[model samples]
Target: MMVDDRAGRPATSSGSEGHVLSTPTLLGDRYQLGEVIGSGGMADVYLAKDQLLGREVAVKVLRDPEPDPTDRARFMSEARTLAGLNHPHLVTLLDAGTSADRPFLVMELVRGTNLGEATRRGGPVPPQRMAEVGAQVAEALAYVHEAGVVHRDVKPGNVLLREDRRVLLADFGIARLVNDTAHHTRVGTTIGSPAYFSPEQVQGLTVTPASDVYSLGLVLLEALTGERAYGGTPTEAAMARLNRNPEIPSTLPAGWVTLLQAMTDPEPTRRPDAQHVLERLRALAGGDDAAATQLANATQVAGATQMMTSVPPAAARPEPTTSVPRAEEPAQKRKRPYWAIAVGIVLVAAVIVALVLLGDRGATVPDVPDDVPSQLRDPLQDLHDSVEEAGQ
Candidate 1:
């Protein structure tokens, strides 16, 4: 299911007769709601017009007229977390308020499909584009994590790909503040989408920024392979990760292989942080060898573990290094061949014998060439004189 940040399958709510909005369904007295663009478990998103700003915005209104207290708190928590974050890669929050007793949130409407749809419509994305997507999403994750927010949902459905080649991470409805101890999940239940959950999330452990990285790794792997990391029912998908790590394809470029493997490591501490992920992804996107090399070294130093079920231990894996030569440096050292030096010596001896024969015939020998080596000249002259005496 493609879950748009603001749009999805129609969710029947009290506000309108199904997905279409009733005439002039105005909220906050400043925005006019139109047709439903997205729907989720919590809210229904509509393409709305902001009367004050005279711009198009997405309005997400609570689906239930009388929601549970905890659900309402989590919905409002998303608003608060989004309000504090102001990153270019993250969707911007416009407004939030209660209208007609329904809590609604206004956000900038991205004018393109989510990554889920894009990948499905257009099969496997190229390596460069995948790198760009990963880098942009990782950038958003780094910012949100630094702001003390953990985006519990980071699947392809939550990532929007704008028409202008820009990426925006959306749908923080299940986001949790890192320091807040209050648990949001019900007993024996998880929060995020099942197929994208990290190992820790599968085990009902604490979720962190690395969890987002693992999810993004799965997303990128799916994008490249055109197959979900985990398939089947929600429970089946969630339980699959606990026993095995997602299989990263061997055909992928080395940089992508290293990054995806490290990101999806079962041990949370072995996964690279969002910032480091961002740096490496950017390097991959830009084809920057130097930056890639630097990040690879950092990944090794940070003990970025590769969680491949079929592979041998880390010590057995070959060391991956980039040794791109600079333009100023020579490609290889010039060396004199042994055969060429031997041929030169033979030619010099033959030339000295010829000079001695000329002097014995009363013919003046030509002056030794100045190009000859100083030490070789004396030896050649002594050999020529001995040959001349033998001829006499």
Candidate 2:
């Protein structure tokens, strides 16, 4: 479930549309809405019971009755994006629809607290536990990035810690497909939480999966240190990342220092991809040489597999298998028009007559090449015989 400090209170300030439920409310004819479990800037999450399936689920309803068109589109886009993704680390989307113009999403109710709240109350997480959480979130990122979606908003509040100790990455409302050009927010407006914004995101540049990697790096660093990588107001925090790299503590293991430094690099491309981050975190969590060896072997196998299936170098791209057919294709399609052959025969006969009349009788007529089509060649031969007889 999305843990919030504002539980049991209304999500909206003045509107009756998003007022807290003092009584049991039935939404979409199948969900029995109870107390609001989580509240955010855009939506309020309720602990609901799925009457149809007889299971406990969390429903997120938009906070405004008359939402901006862009917000509504983003709400629906989250539903669509989550519906297609199925992964262990990702929160599953069960159902979605609008009730009286207020959109809602039904997801599996994760009985747990978010990483932000957990860390705030419990202080810094141990290094091994932090690595575990980072690994899980990184694995989730790897999955979503492969599916062409960039989780533009990746932070501690969005990372849920289940009671069973499994971590889930949730709240994909601001997420967008990497190839999707239609943005929910207007141009020049940044979307994610300011403190967690990647450098490219702070500058309002085109964001990619690398931006998510950067944000996750910040998240992991905070999990380890119990402090944000940047401070001050939203604008100051967002701009600070662009000016310099996050401060990774010297007390962290050398492996962690290296990973955090690489992840929070000022240059987006300098950061490691999510899959690599996942492997590194997992190895770190293992805390032994055996795990390091396993990671090395896995990486070697992955490299060899990638090389085997990768596009061949330019030298081998022009396939020899198709070259023979390519060379013969033009000859196979070579065809001459019959009318041209006839015109040529007439022109040749006229030339011969002109030469004879001019007293150059030794000059001979030229014959057609052997490659002419039989359909025209046979007719030309008959025409040639007729011309010879007429001349005689």
Candidate 3:
């Protein structure tokens, strides 16, 4: 359950439509609203019971009822960004809709403490634990980047650590899709938390996956030092990194110092991708790359166990001496989910449609700030409409 910012009162706030979705309130005829677990500037997060799934979920409802169209569109973009992602270390978006013109996102409720609260209560984490947490986040970001998403905010508060000490990066409210033009990301208006902002972000520059790496670097630094690496107001903190680097202790765990510095480097091009960071952490933690190793083995097995290829039937079909798909004995017991393949094909088609839209929009540039991209001109009106349609 999320902690209510207003400790004493019920987690009730008037929505743009002038209604409060308090406890016992039923949303979409499925989610039984419970305690107000968390609150933020834009939305109030409620712990709700999913009657359909028979599980707990966190419902984040937008606070602004009378938001301008731009705000509404940005909300939809955030939702679509979350919807496109599917990864273990990222909070999954299960459902989304609107209640009385107020959009809400139904997400998997993550238990255990957020990294900010955990670090505050426990101080710096154990070295091995830190590396493990970092690895999980990096791996997740790698996946997110591969999907053409940039998590603009990568901070401790946005990271949740489960009981197993595994970490999940959450809160992509300000995340920008690859073809997204930052209409909201105007000059003189920075998007991310200042303490964790990259140097280019401070200057209002175009961001890439490496920008997330720089921010994650600060988060891990705070985890290790038990102190914030930057100081002053958000604006001041944003500007501080312009002339200086994060002060790191000369002494760090074997490979961490090098990794940390590279991540926080002022130059965006200098930072390593999330995958490399994950690989380095795995090396330092002395853990085998189970996922990579399995992929390699699966590739070899699949190639050798092809049922019918250019070769003759007897040569193509390996003798079924063993149950697993291997060269010598290729008795295949597992079959891939055809439905999953169909879904993949459908999603690819949808993306191709979206790409055409992106291309069409690229022809007509928006009158946005120099910092914003020319190709990202369209207001996410279509995405915003989809949210309402989903809810209905």
Candidate 4:
């Protein structure tokens, strides 16, 4: 359910068997396919009518009708994995089968845009709302972690924003099934999107739930900052992380700065577990459950309405819109630019160290990111940069 770009591509119908699909197609004599809703690298999702169930469902069909046994096995693994998860923060897997050896799955049609679209439309999410969304996603991640699964790919594109303005973390590791890294690596293709890849994953180490937490941290950072922490060519972005930490901006709520730093810590072991992350985020959301319940009900109503109406093709919805972040917090609460305080702390520490080392020599301190490692911000580097700045 990575319902946006980068998780997969949109559909291209060449023919019925190996190419594009036709509308009004019947699958298993029970589901009536309408228009193609979403498409990714390996599958095409359609808004379809579940005739037997008397409801609308998102039907995902494999593009390759005659995929090899390995592909089939991987598809079945997604089915098996999804069958075990029943969290409200996840996309519900309804049914699955093969027609002419083409695999397809019937899913609960979540009538909402993905987080990528939402963020682009709404800009940076408000602090409280970000906490609510992140908490919901973390809760889902906690459940899957307990179930012994890792959502290797956790990005904004895979997160859905419901009509009620809440969100759900979708796909639950399904991307790993189709994103075969071996061949991609052989051809110099990145194993995953560099902007969201964890350090361990980029390093080719054994990925665990910790990796998922790292990816989640990046996604949360992007949602809150209205910017990606890393970019450039895939290799450059991934390798950049090996030397430096994410820029936690000189602006952010204090709690968010602390929580995000902990979550995105260079050492995976230092990062908090999903449940702990969920607890912290829930605290940030201000212990509200009634509002969340109302949001869920809104989503249910929206889904029901979509079920009754005919869905337009993906092209018809060129830009999916989302609700603006609620900006009604009282003035007593502060949120923006908390990272300025962090910078101040780093500056004070640096000055104290410089005074101790310089023995009262009057010299200006150089500016740097708050979290720059001591090794990179060594005395020599600072002296060199300071001298260079003075000359300029």
Itemize residue pairs with steric clashes in candidate 2: 1-110
- In model 4, how large is the Cα lDDT of residue 317? 19
Q: Is candidate 1 or candidate 4 better by lDDT?
A: 1
Candidates in order, TM-scores: namely 0.72, 0.71, 0.68, 0.65
The candidate, 1 or 3, that scores higher on lDDT is: 1
User: Which parts of model 2 have CA positions greater than 4 angstroms off?
Assistant: 3-20, 289-392
RMSD values for the candidates in order, in angstroms, are: 26.4, 20.3, 18.5, 15.8
Q: Estimate, for each residue in 232-334, the C-alpha lDDT of model 4 and write its tens digit.
A: 8877777666656687764776566656765675556545678777877886688454443344333323321111012221112111122212122111222
On residues 20-81, what C-alpha lDDT tens digit does candidate 3 reach at each position? 45537778888887766666657767778899989988888776777656667777878888
lDDT over C-alpha atoms for residue 371 of model 4: 49
lDDT of 1 at 372: 49
- Backbone clash pairs for candidate 3 read 2-37, 16-65
lDDT of 4 at 245: 69
Look at candidate 2 and tell me the lDDT of residue 253: 74
The most accurate candidate by lDDT is 1
> How do the residues 1-392 of candidate 2 rate in per-residue lDDT, one tens digit apiece?
45333342332222233444878878899999987777776777887889988988889888888988888988999999999899999999999988888989999887667788778878999988888889999999999988888899999988988778899999898888877878788666667889899877886667778788889988998988999989899988987664456777779876677667666755555456788878888988888535644453344234311111121322222212111212232334434433444466667556645644665434454565555546557766665455445555
| Model 1: per-residue Cα lDDT over 1-392, one tens digit each | 11243344322223342466546688988989878777777787888889998988888888889977777887888888889889899999989999877788899887767778778878999888888988999899888887778898899878888767788999989998877777655666567799999977876667777788889989999998999989999988987765456777768877777777777766676678888888998998998745665786678565644322322333333333432221211212113332343456567677667766565565443434434445567876677566656655
